[model samples]
Target: MKEGIFFGEGMKFVKDDYPDIYDAVVGLNKAAYTGKVLDYKTQKLIAIGIVAATGDETATEKQMRSGMNELKITKEEIVDALRVVLLTSGMPAFTKAMKVVSKL
Candidate 1:
């Protein structure tokens, strides 16, 4: 969800130390987010489910927040994605994702 950073990484370091790399990453993000077949909102929801499935709390929270803020994705929509996460990823991931959603 961050422009050029993933998880809680510092963007300034990447921007200052690896400017080209940072730009490429940002460019990748742009390409990834551009809606083609699936809309960006749906893409965002898929992203949420993915990070949630991986059980990465910080990334999951960030993606969830980004989807909600930027795309107006609802809690219900997130929960629906979490259902898929539950099926593919299991209870622990689902619980952790639910916790993140609860905090929001």
Candidate 2:
């Protein structure tokens, strides 16, 4: 069985630990601020894209997996997002991310 990230005590050393609670708080803020600041769905996609774009393989993998699980993002959408990153971030980052994404 694969272990997914959890928001319990063990992860507090990482920034934005307690993601379960942090997500809730962010949700509340989004609701309060006219409910259209950054859509949750879009935020998830953007986060996955940014992580992948930056070539942070560990974070990119984690965010991609989580975003897919939580948001039902299609593999095609993930691929398309990576393509855009390739255009903007150049080959090195793109190739690195592609290797990891391909493995998944």
TM-score on alpha carbons, each prediction:
0.89, 0.65
Error of 2 at 101 (Å): 1.8
For candidate 1, write residues 8-87 as lDDT tens digits: 46766887899998788888888897787888889889999999999999889999988888779999999999999999
Clashing pairs in 1: none
Residue pairs clashing, model 2: none
The prediction achieving the highest TM-score against the true structure is 1
lDDT of 1: 0.88
Q: 53-86 in candidate 2: lDDT tens per residue?
A: 7788887877777667877876677778888888
Task: Quote model 2's TM-score.
Answer: 0.65
Clashing residue pairs in all predictions, respectively, total: 0, 0
The lDDT of each candidate is 0.88, 0.68
